[model samples]
Target chain A: MAGEREQPAEPLTLRRVAASHAAARVVVSASFEVAAGEIVGLAGPNGCGKSTLLRTVAGLHPCERGEVVLPRSRTPAGVARVALVPQGYAQSFWPWASLRSGIALAASGSGRGWYRSAAARAQSLRAELALDLDLGLRPYQCSGGMLQQAALLRALAAFASGPEVLLADEPFSALDVDVARRARAALRRFVRERGVRALVVLHDVESLVETCDRVLVIDGKPWSTDGASEGVSTARMVLNARLGSRRPDGDADAAAPTTSSFGDAMARVLGAGPHP
Target chain B: MTKGSAGRLALAAATFAAGLALWLALARSGWIGRTLLADPIDVARALAGAFDPAAPPGARVLVHAEATLVRALAGWVIALLVGMGCGVALGARAWAYVLGEPLFELARAVPPILAFPLLLVAFDFGEPAYVGTIVLGCVPIVAITVARGRLGASRERSELLAVFGVPRSVRALTAIMEVMPSCFLAARLALSTSLVIAVVTEMVFTPRSGIALGALAKEAQMSFETDVYFAVVVVVGLFGYAANVVLRAVERRLGLERSTST
Candidate 1:
């Protein structure tokens, strides 16, 4: 009878999350959920609380009033299952630590055996990304592109031991077109192969269109668009519409068209244009 | 040797040679008294005499030197632990910084030596007094330097750690590690100051608990044993210099020197 008892499933959920700073509340009563094997993207302008929302979800920033529920693993062993790849990969990786040591620390924190499992994951990721450098190099020795790739690899190695969700905050900001595209492709393949849920924050609409299955636009709040490669147009339209309603002046129309053009170009890029 | 090390050694040798030449010229001209300032050879002889097996010099110099080292190290370690902790706490909390800034500044502005009389009254002439003098002298310097270094750590690094859901202890460790080179530099400087304070306190207080090199030097001065006094001064100087060199080596091994040099 005990063996026959059914076990409950694990889910990562956020409810009514709100964040405030010095009388300015950026994210108010926003909620989102990511099931296993799903990739969600949060896209918005620079001060749109995308990063704040991710931080709250990852349990990095405390919500003023909200709940983040990370369901326990089904196995007898309990684990708080979440990893985050922060923005500015160069800054995230410890400059003093070698790539191997840094990745090992990250992996060890998750209670995973870092020597064998984590090393294999790192080597696989390096091979996946086609990185020429060995694991012993320090962060400062690597270029921005290399560091970004290594940061992603570190996150992957940490999360590889079991089925766990990941939060990546602006993984490809300030990168040139070629590297950004490469990173996006690498992330997509890694996520697909691992079958892990992720919420990636993106500043550029085009990157979300290419990498994310579903896009959630956060201006002052959260809004979700349909899941499709072509849905980027829909997401952009919603962004402009929200921006226009907030502005309401004649400048709204002028700004709307420029943003729309930019979004459209982004959509085309995401839709299958050559790497810029 | 690396080109950089070679250059530094050459510069050091050149400066030493020039200083030696000046000392020789001065001694030959007899402008400065030989008793007051011995020639290089005479100073060397005095150094040899101080440690010579045949003469069997008094244990006073060794005892005083050991005492000074013990007091300085004890005070330095205590100051480092307490000061760095307070610095991290203040750096993490803005209100703490606001509340503690004025007190810290006032305490730092007052030199440790100036408090020797008050400490003497409280702790009396003994080990406690000497240690108190050193701690009172060194803690504020350590605190100010560490606090400043902590404050100067990159905000982006904090945000990055926060975004990763890192616990508070992990965040603090990372932040401290990020700024450790700066803290180490401050500690090195504080070490030199601690030695100076240790000597000054021993000299001023003249504690009867044990032999003190400063007190011995003072006695030599009164007795006009200039060679012995100068020899003791050179020993203290060598100790300080050696300590600094050791710390510099540690800094290099920690990779702080590379970033600093570049």
Candidate 2:
């Protein structure tokens, strides 16, 4: 009788989403709700459709057979309110535009006069990010960390305009430990301050535990649990089990945890310890 | 200021002085014919004399320069606007590129000078002919640059825009801004090419209505006024340098360098 009870609909909803590449089809079907200010983490093995799911949610990838519905007050006017901060800092930015201009462009739509006061916005963003960059310098001139911070600043500027949801796909993939920690902290603070719901796609359980309120482990499919701090160990175990089962040849167990370097670091940070 | 800026300025000055010294030494030694390469002093004097109000002021130089500038600017503006628009369309769609690739490649391969005879046949040697030549030279360069810039914009960012429910105009503007640096660089190179074409077109085909500076220089050479010829050469060099400086300043103001480096 309890199992038969109808589930409450979410502000954002995805049902029976499926994706495919040239090689194979990855299927995903799940139902989840995210309230305002909630931080959700998605963890899974490599190529397990974690990033794919996030990309689909962000409208980057078209779903094979599913529906992604964003809350619309009226039935006729359908629009999803979401912002995505992609994985790579370098890829996310326009290499030609200055940090200030890029961020301002992200903040303001094609309204002619919105960009008139770009200088003031840029100065505030630079200060907020603790970046002492010459707003004149291009993307190529900055280091990786600097680019990431600049990107984060751009995302914050966009978020300021009240996008309901933020989809971050492996925000710390290439960053070093210290920088990643700082960035993760900043992201957490942003979610809290803005009261914006976030669905962060990551392979590392530790980062999820550190930054997310709930963890959704998509080993074979989507299996979610509340309290990411406590759920990290379970997530790691699920990841290890998935890796063990799918790993190739006699060296499968001996090949170690293959969930990316960032994932490995995250495991350590989440108290799952280093790869055994 | 910084030591680096000072050092660069010194290096530039030294190079200019060395070039001048070499020119003087060659003239003094009579290694090259004095008729062909006039004395620097004589060239300077001729330059001053040409500009003097008392002497029949050769406002010809200014007139020629203005004509060339007008042709170059008109052709460049037309080429850049049209080329970039077409390029964005092609760049955004693979099928468009495939469809237009052969025509673009063919047009780009044919030199503007070669196209001059065709224009002469059509327009019968006038401003249209010269402007047509410049447009022929510049459009391909701008189009290619715009195409490349559009290709270079991240798919991720475009998807982000879609996710945010941004309007079509907003998407286009963002895409253009993302590719603006490449477009600017391409436009600058195209401007230089357009200037060269303007001069060449003027030199080869002297219009009945206008005596272009390039034709005037040629006339001076034919009459063996070596100093006047060199003065024209100096004027051309100054104009080219000034154009380059202006373009660089515009590039800086638009944050083109910043986008390029990143």
Candidate 3:
């Protein structure tokens, strides 16, 4: 249920949100709810509409049949209600706009009168996210992983002051192991401290099991008829795991099971091919 | 200068010298008729005489240059506004592109100068006709280049703005900024075309008043003042080169020197 604008944060609910590309329906009435302060991981097979589903929730993709009833906004008029960290990190920024400009643009809308200017708003977001990087650097000048972090920063900057949700698609795919670990902590702290919800489509079972408060397996069916639904309901929407959120010590890795022992059931949901 | 640039400069100077020598030889041999070609020295003297304050008012090339610049720039501004606006619109909408692309292509296929007669009929013989001619010549090229630039913009950036709910004004500004390189190219091409079309129209129809470079060329050719004709040719060439240099400097200022179509 959506909380009142001035009330405490409530869950972001998707009521039969369906999306199609051309004639083929990629998502078939996929319904789910993500409670505030929770980090939910979405797992599905490769070529499935996992990314598309995230886009649908973020209001990027067109929802054809149903509505994505967004949570009541406590955010001021200028802030984004929902933000998405889309795939393709490197191309997320134009050659002209710097890392700071990208964030500043999104934050500028939300800053209202709270900040001095767009650049100032961007600076505040960097401080809030605990990210340290040169905001002056262009996307082409930065490494792929750095671009991913920058992309994430710009995403969060939109809803930083307002009550909103973040939908990310494999944000860690570009980061190295060491960077990914730190990113997990920062994300955990942001979600917990802000009491906001985030739904991320994870690439691996380890990340799904360790970082998320809960995991939901969306449909694994690929669009066959060029976005027209074969009208099949073969997907068994499963809540496969109820793993707790990141550990307070910031070493959620120790509490998580190894990839081999996490069981094939979870692996299959994460699109890691069936266990032998 | 760097080795590459120095070498390029040397080669260009040598090529120019060789062309001048060949022209002198052709004139001396009387192979080309005197009415059609002037001696290189005579043309240079006439060119220098244009800058000489003591020269006749008719020989003052600055007045002609000013008219050409004004007419060309006026046309260029109109083309810039119309082309960029249309290009951005067509670029954003696929259906618009589908409907507009064919018309743009058809319009582009016809030489812009060919529209001079139509414009003459529509607007009558005046500065308006000449400006309309230049717009017809260059606007399609600008629109097409900018549309391609819009299409080539970083998709992720576009999506980022869309999802982040950046205001439409912010997004439009971003879109326009992304197409700067292409716009620069279109502007450059349009600048030259505008100059050429302005002169050509002036040549075709002598303005009732005001000095015009094209009219000067036509008058010199009619009177068989081949030296004056060649001097005007040289002046036009210099104008084109100077415009290019200024554009390059502006590109450097904006950090866009590495690309013209990126």
The interface root-mean-square deviations, each candidate in sequence, come to 4.1, 2.6, 3.5
lDDT by residue (A1-276, candidate 3, tens digit) is: 122323345678877676765566667766667877778887767766778778878767788766776677665553336777778777666665567766677654554552245566556766765565688986667888888888777666655453368888998888777767777777776666665778999877667755687666543453221123336534334334455333334321111222323334664444333312
Query: Model 1: per-residue lDDT, tens digit, B71-160?
Result: 888888877777777766666566777787777778878888898888788875557777777777777777777777667666555665
How much is the lDDT of residue A253 in candidate 1?
23
Candidate 2 chain A: 10-residue stretch with minimal lDDT: A241-250
Best by TM-score: 3
Off by over 4 Å in 3: A1-9, A76-80, A113-132, A159-163, A222-233, A236-239, A244-265, A268-276, B1-44, B118-124, B150-155, B178-181, B218-227, B245-262
Please give the distance, in angstroms, between residue A182's alpha carbon in candidate 1 and its true position after superposition. Answer: 3.0
TM-score of 3: 0.78
lDDT of 1 by residue, A79-188 (tens): 55567777756666665567786665566544435446777778877786665547887766777766766777777776544336778888877567887777777776
Evaluated at residue A138, the lDDT of candidate 2 is 73
For candidate 3, the lDDT comes to: 0.71
Per residue, candidate 2 scores C-alpha lDDT tens digits across A1-276 of 222333223456666555654445554344465656667777766776777777777767777766766655221334434667777667666665667766666655424454545446557656755554676667787777677666666666653334467788777766677767777776776665555678888766556656775555554422222212222333222232112222121122321243545445434444343345
The candidate that achieves the highest DockQ relative to the unseen native structure? 2
Error of 1 at A270 (Å): 5.5
Cα deviation at A12, candidate 3, in Å, is 1.7
Model 3 pairs whose backbones collide: A23-A227, A23-A228, A24-A226, A24-A227, A24-A228, A25-A227, A25-A228
Ranking by TM-score: 3, 2, 1
- Of all native A–B interface contacts, model 1 reproduces a fraction of 0.18
lDDT of 2 by residue, B190-228 (tens): 878887888788788876656576676777788898887
